[model samples]
Target: MNSLFLISSAIIIFAIAYVTYGAWLSKQWGVDPSRETPAHTMNDGVDYVPASAPVLLGHHFASIAGAGPIVGPIVAAIFGWIPVMLWIIIGGIFFGGVQDYGSLFASIRHDGKSIGQIIEVNIGKTGKRLFAIFAWLTLLLVVAAFVNIVANTFVSVPQAATASTLFILLAVFFGFAVYRRGVPLAIGSIIGVALLFACIWAGMKFPLVLSKNTWIILLLGYIFVASVTPVWILLQPRDYLNSYLLYAMIAGAVLGLLMYRPEIQLAAFSGFNVGGKYMFPMLFVTVACGAISGFHSLVGSGTSSKQIDKESDAKLIGYGGMLVECVLAVIALITAAYIGGDKLKELLSNGGPINVFSDGVGTFMTRIGIPLEVGKPFTALAISAFALTSLDTATRLARFIFQEFFEDKTKEKQSILVTNRYLSTAITVGLGGLLAVVGWQKVWPLFGSANQLLAALALLALGAWLANVGRNYKMIILPMIFMFIVTLTALVQLIIANIKTNNFILVLFGVLLFVLALVLIKQSYKVLSGSERKGMKA
Candidate 1:
């Protein structure tokens, strides 16, 4: 098994899927170009700013991709490359892509509301409330896990810390110049990307060193600001600019693999049970964002839908963005495979998957005449940048879910806690920060199960909405069913494991999520069965 061969095959498969299956979905879902998107009709200059396809793709991809595709694949490669590769390709195209695209389309059609609100429209107010609580809690797990990831990355790779900080300040300037001052997009992008590279270079020259705890606190503060501020100011431009780093990193890795053609040293199959973990649900849960994630639904519906300039962009930004992540996941998997199982375990025990990924890509870049010192840090910085992207994006999404839960549909006004973005963001960030201090390793498994479960519920919502609107929702049905089984099984295992370990907090969360998912599933079943369509608006 050669790395180049595997990646090439995956790329071809993804391209074909995007053209044939992705196009079929668009046509089936009735993507009308003439219809005005929410971004235009509900333009608020903050959350509802319309963006061109490319810029929106950058933001959507950056937010959803984050370290998910990287972290999930590398960690799940414990089951060997074959299973991970298969899931990334199959799940990305059919499962993740469909959910992401459907969620975006559903939200846009419903006036750019979050998935919770979508549930309210197609299901009922009760279903929406339950889903909102589940979604918000899941977002907290996301924020905690990613914040821990970023903080640890900064402490281990201080140069990335410097680059990430510089990236934020530069994004603010880029957002102001391109969005507010009316600078041309092309010229501004050129300058921004060039400056981005300069920041990386400067980071290597002068690194920023900080304690892990201190970095965590600073990161919490940063996300609080990021969640409350206008999207254009930090989220959009930072993600847009940060996307180029990922693009370059992927391009570099692929080009190096093409040149080097490294052999897949890891075994094809590592048994169903390795180290007391069964492959049944653990493998699926572990390869989450790489295959399919519920988190992507939140991002697509929560933020990307609001910024979409048109409905047609949903396919490219949603479906296409997911495939792009599949490509990255393939790359991450190769990094682990090329190192062999033994070295991978050693690296995992030492610095975790991100370091393994950076080192592998750094070695690859050497084939293209780039120094390992530079290439490794560049890769590290890119991953850290995206992790930070996920951190703040999760915070914002969490804030959205929190605020939406309190919104009174029958009333004309809302409370300050709900209306005040600052207060809401602070509360969300504060809670997530508490979880972050618990460490990512403790939280990742629960997060993975919760994330995949969230995907299941999102699919349920999409299926219900599609059925309500009289469209053929056959595409969403199988994926929805499969995810429920996988995530439910994983959650049960997690609960048992946590109880044995006396980790009551995680056990409590696991039980809560399992119950919420079951309740949502029951409600969606009613809607799908035509027994609960009394107030359905779709």
Candidate 2:
């Protein structure tokens, strides 16, 4: 029941999986090192710029990690650390990693298209449209939920707000210097990280206090600009720099846990039914990002695939990135388990899971000679930074989906609404802003269900594509089927719960997403069946 044992075990398992299972997947999917990737062939300095493996990994990991691995595991701890831990390790390797890896690989092959566009190529145009609608709607939920979470964090921890602002300004300069001014990456990175730490110290000295609503407004405006700007100027560099904060936090936590070795205070199992929620589907849905998420596929296909220098980097950024998140999820579970029952409840009620994680990690840092005052705020700042990363990344991806939805291949010139980047981004962020005021608590359950369902659809698309190409698609079958059942069940429960509470808006969305899933599944099934028949004849 020692925390060190649990965390160390997870690290070892993930490391082994990265080399063995991850490499095996690359080979099975026919990763061609000699082939030119979209980043090189379609090199537009805007979204399609090529990046080294490390830079893309940082961007990919930061965008996908967000508050997901931390929030989901801590929140789902109501079902006990045992079930949550099992899912993080098992589900992360087989379900999440494969989906992320496959999605990225698939996108690069199809000219750096989003998963929805990939669906269009492999399944059909109708399948692509349906998937795009579902994916965009799910992204809206992501924008709303994370916007609320980050705004609240800024309100409660003003120093983190100050630090995050500094991080943004620093990233802009770093991007210009490294990408435009010909500053060497290694030296630029050294200066960037050093100044990043200074931002934290300066944040503590001069906190930027603001109301939650005010922060929400400012954040919406920030993502609007972030979504339309060139990736190298903001998105890529910001994520790359912010990644160091996470790396330091993780390293510090592991070092502290090794030295401190706190005992697991929570019970192994808290029963299948706790607080009128059944663990069957709720547990699977709640522990999403840590285990598997539909969202990661978006980050992989939507952004990272566009910047990849070669096909070889996809496995590292996709599969290896997911395993790294599983490590963070394990650390999050331990933080909750170490806090025991009463304090965990109090923290959840007051500041939510982020507070619980911050406090636990703050205590861990004490063993390594860091004070709680500094350590806790630093953890808060790191997490909020990533949440902000997800916010803007989601906005960009949503814009991509929205534009893709309106795209007509038959037309030579697209409409302004679709071609105009600002208009599309404004529409996406504006809708998400309206929902941000609804609060994350009201939106999380439906988001979880829809997010998982998105994963199922992505898996379905991957399966159909592999089968169509006569590749070995058996690896994708079980995860795709399991996600469909889990997410569909979760959506049903959410609909019933929303109706009882008289929340018709969420109920409507839940029903719409459900219908969309069924229709897409039917479309994909035909493709799979036809491919099987073709193979039999050949």
Candidate 3:
């Protein structure tokens, strides 16, 4: 609950990791990224893009800074601030940062081929296909889980959905103008962004809330069209601009904490670790991004790689972005600490994560010069910004997974690229749509396991990558092993819980994920069983 203590802890731990562990890991697993940039290089400022290091950093941070920082800590704090704070700082800077930086350097040094491609390239073709299959299934869950998150955020603020819709429209115009016309991208970007804000303001003033059925249709339309659109306009720019919103929100939170030094209020603070039923099993899984996430590595390799300007940029984009997320987590901790236990339960049960966040952040801002009425809505808008960022990115990733699944290695015919991409979008969007409609009352419990399932998959992939890097395999082996054990333990608990609740759907889902984990472990081990890198040199 002490905002300063949380922030200081994160920074101090990050410093420790940077000096002792991060440096040692770099020495061990680090590879020269310069040589590989030539192959998958992009000369155009869009796909094969170049930007200043900071802008690229912003892109990476914005892409990764979704609802995780806000929701994870808030949910996990049921265990107590001490426990939540411990893992977030230690696990975040050490375990999470290493995974993210390693994944970035690995992918960048491999010419921006995805983690799946890196797994295959370094391991074997069969290994690569297996990784892709696991990734596909993981992406499906990502679409289902995150789309529901975005939908809920939007459902709370029906007017904000209009802002998202307008943002998409402007992206279409910007995409067409730059790609199909003679307009410079810089000029187009400015105009498009201005128009997007205009629409957001209009939406707020009018407060449009379409019927649930019509609302779902409109949202689906945006998903399919936006997912299929070229990345230059929407995906890249939306993420780029949204970073400002996210950062502003975080900055506001930090500034508010500084100006208004609120004491911690939870009775659970410094309490005994009486977890399990309260916050025991749920702690690590719910607070994913601030500590460790399997998803960031995917984004690091997949989309962020396309925009990186230079070799050393990996440090900025990966490591720096993660630090920013940790700070956001600290702010979230302050919110949890500020809102005591009883009110916290009321907030949780009432179903308004954004409002709780807004109330906390708004309190901080209110102490400063900002008015409460304005600051609260602005805080809510920031939540919407992150939610939308996650929504679009999840859609794109799911599309990538779907496309990768049907990627037949034929010379002349491109099956997945052309027809299969649309099919993939449909499948991905439909699954997300289904979740938005039916995935009710499923919060930290289900989503936590799902997110960790991703972390497990990522670690499994990391272990494979690290093994091929030869001398540095030990750097990742421990974390990978730890996450593997944790996943196995959590999987067991998940199955038992499902049985008790008589939720056959979740039981089946958890079992399927468990099998995927086992398969990935077996496949990764098969490749890493004293095998040499079989990649064709570009």
In every candidate, how many clashes are there? 1, 0, 2
**How do the residues 1-538 of candidate 2 rate in per-residue lDDT, one tens digit apiece?**
8888999999999999999999899888988878899999999888898998988899999999988899899989989889999999999999999999999998998889999998888778988998898888778988888898888888888998999999999999999999999999999999999999999999989999989989999999999999998899989899999999899999989999999999999888999999998999999899999999999999999999999998999999999999999999999999999988789999999888888999989989999999998899889999999999999999999999999999888999998778998999999999999888865456566888888988998899888877777788888989999999998988898899899999987898889988998988888888777733233210
lDDT of each: 0.89, 0.90, 0.69
Better of 2 and 3 by TM-score: 2
> What lDDT tens digits, residue by residue, belong to model 3 across residues 382-435?
677676676667677767656655666565686755455678788778877776
Candidate 1: Cα lDDT at 68? 74
Candidate with the larger TM-score of 1 and 3: 1
Find the 10 residues in a row with the least total lDDT in model 1: 529-538
What is the model-wide C-alpha lDDT for candidate 3?
Answer: 0.69
Q: Which residue pairs show collisions in model 3? A: 42-48, 276-280
In candidate 3, stretches whose alpha carbon ends up further than 4 angstroms from where it belongs are 9-27, 31-33, 36-52, 124-130, 169-203, 268-280, 410-420, 438-446, 526-538
Q: Write the per-residue lDDT of candidate 1 for residues 226-297, one digit (tens) a residue.
A: 888888888999999999999999999999888989999998889899888898988889888898999999
- Candidate 1 regions exceeding 4 Å error are 438-444, 534-538
Q: Estimate each model's TM-score.
A: 0.97, 0.97, 0.87
Ranking by lDDT: 2, 1, 3
